[model samples]
Target: MYQYDAYDQQLVDERVAQFRDQTRRFLAGELPEDEFRALRLRNGLYVQRFAPMLRVAIPYGLIAAKQMRMLAHIARRYDKGYGHFTTRQNIQYNWPKLEEVPDILADLASVQMHAIQTSGNCIRNVTSDHLAGVARDELLDPRPYCELTRQWSTFHPEFNWLPRKFKIAFSASQSDRAAVRVHDIGVQIVRNETGELGYRIYVGGGLGRMPMIGPLIKPFLPELDLLSYLEAVLRVYNRLGRRDNIHRARIKILVKDIKPEKFAELVEAEWAQLREGELKLRHADIEAMRQRFDQFTYDPAAAQDRSYAKHLEQDSAFASFAKRNVLAHRVDGYAVLFVSLKSPSGVPGDISAEQMEVVADLAERYSFGEVRATHDQNLVLADVQHKDLYTVWKTLREHELATPNIGLLTDMICCPGLDFCSLANASSISVAQDINDRFDALDHLHDIGELKLKMSGCMNGCGHHTVGHIGILGVDKHGEEWYQVTLGGSAGNDASLGDRTGPSFSRADIAEAVERIIDVYLEARDSEEESFLACYRRIGMAPFKARLYAEEAVEAA
Candidate 1:
């Protein structure tokens, strides 16, 4: 994790003081609502349906154990007893009072965290692979670059108010776990034939009313030119992107209207001027940033524990947890353990204050005092020792954090829908609950295998439904709640948007429709090993659509 220097600390402290005064003025009627709106948004505060929501940035999804404890404290003291972890790897407080937000920001600042640039039409949090430094197939660690980008973009005067919100993600592994293809800018760290590291930059990728997989703009951007190239892309979009219509304001829209080739040409022309400018990364600076991250000390005897093998053989429950929640780490004796927030008892990403504290304790005790928030709304203890698996599993199970449903049907990515978001059309949390009840059987979910079900309350695509194997979008039709389903979408290296399954389903029928879709997949699959996504891709949408609408077709007849 990158520790803040005096300048960073001073900047945040000054911002906190500035926002506190601004907030006081707004309440005192000295600041106009319109003016305050921009100021509050820049600080990551949003007025929701019932209360104010505060989104705190967890840069590149990395948080120290102490920061996690601060988050728990904030949840307990300022907002509701729980907070929601978002798809962007940030945390959201749904019930924070308007007057107390400055206090929250101050509390966050104490831990070197803040809500700056988390919202508004600016470059939001710079995200990366949750498995960044620890993935076996990684070509380079993307966190240093992510941190560099974050430092460069925070409060950049040129991009402070873009046409629309901008997002950037980085991935270094062979597998694109960061979902880089769906970001406004996606940087894939790659090594060329000469073994020199650089980036494969993709531009114009986004999901909303118009979903797109970003096209490759620069197949090989030099290591030193990252910031310069990004500036060029932003400059092009900031100049030509639509300002008249919010719907058409995103860079994706501009890229679409102009064609990707033209967009690339414009970016290239801009880069030709700025490539060797002040934004160019120096080798010394890069090395210094890399050295800031603390390395973990792994136990040499971790892999030699016979008790771990015995526990796996003796306890079926522990074995199942180890099988589902544990992922292979780059280190020989370490594993990445997922703390599932998707327990059937509550909302997908919502974690209670006590639960947060538990995770912090576990992270400190087992994973080198570090925690990672995943884009899929899960917490990861990225460096747990192999020998401590059973103890960690037991502790997590006791706290309802060991769901053993990672990448399963029940382990879904969902947004705070009508329940919290004023822009939502229907209730995402309730829909998720309904689906969880329907597919409560772990054995059944395991049989279905590796399904990514993402649900969004509206077309904002906050839940990333377009990229799920099964995408559910909530819609309002004549004041009634309905859901539109899509199939075969993926956020992987081979990213693609899903195809809609004909008509929308009533709230009552949505879960059943999902069940019917799953039934069709199970019956049609060549073998148990074939995933739902694989089967859907092989047979196409015809079969799933037919199954989903078969009853409606009969009723119509």
Candidate 2:
């Protein structure tokens, strides 16, 4: 985790004080509601259904144990006793009082955290792979680049107000765990044929009402030009992006209308002017940022431990948790442990204050005091010793954080829909709960195998429903909540928007509809080795749709 330098600290402190004054003015009626709304949104405060929601950024999804403790303190003192982790690697406090939000910002600032750039149609949080440096197949750690970009974009004078909210993601892993392909700007760190590092830039990728994968704008851009090239891209978007219509104001829409090739050409022309300018990345700066990430210390002796293998054979429950939650680390003796916030006992991403403290303690004890938040609303203890796996699992189990359902049907990506969001047409939390209860049998979930089920209350796609293997979108039909299902969507390297399965199902039948679709996959799958996405890709959605609509007809008759 990169500790804040003096510059970073000063910026956050100033922003907090500025917002505190703005909040005071608004509360005193010196500022109108409309004027205050924009100011509040710029600071990550939103007026939701019942109360204000505050989104705090976890840059590159990296947080130290101390920062986690601070978040727990904020949740306990300010809002309700919990916070919802989001798909963008941020956390939201849904019930914070409007007047006290400035104090909450102050609390976050003490821990080197802030809400700036987390909201308000500017460059949002810069997310990266949770595993970053620890992943076995990572080409390079993307955190330094992410950090540099975050600093460059924070309150950038030229891009302070873009046409719409923009998102950026970086992924260096062989597997695209960061969902890079679906972001506004997805950068893949790659090596050229000459063995020089560079980036493969994808522009115009986004998922909402109009879902599309960003096309490759630059096949390979030199590493030295990372910042300059990014500036060019933003410059082009800011100049030409639409402001007439809110729905079509995103960079994706601009790219779609003008075509990606033209967009790239415009960016390239802009880069020609700014390539070696002040924003050009320097080697010393890169190295300094990289040095901050080199904190992991592994014990070579743990590599020789045979106890982990023995324990796996001896304990089925522990083995299940290990198989599902434990991930391969680059070091021989180390492991990356994913803590599931999607336990069936609670909402998909809500972590209680107590759980936050427990996670912080576990990270300090077993993972070198570091934790990473995932894009799927999970948490990662990225550096655990292999020999200590059983003990870590036991601790997580006691805290209800070890759910042994990673990549399975029960581990769903959902949004706080109509229950909390004013933009929602239906309730996503209830749908997720129903699906979890219906698939509570661990054996059944394991059999389902690698299903990415996501749901959203409305078309805003906060739940990322467009990218799920079985995407469920809630729609309002004459004041009735009906769920629409999509299949064959994936957020990985082969990112594709899901296709609609059939007509929408009633709220009562949504879970059963999901079960029927799963049953169809089970029957049609070539083998257990075939995942839900793989099988759907092989057979298409016709079989699932036929089965689902057939059930609908039977009920109608």
* Top-scoring candidate (lDDT): 1
Candidate 2 total steric clashes:
1
97-124 per-residue lDDT for model 2 (tens digits): 9889999999999999999988888999
Clash totals for all candidate models: 0, 1
Please give, for residues 259-320, the per-residue lDDT of candidate 1 as tens digits.
99999999999999999889989999899999888876778888776787899999999888
Candidate 1 backbone overlaps, count: 0
Taking every candidate in turn, the Cα RMSD to the unseen true structure, in Å, is 1.2, 1.2
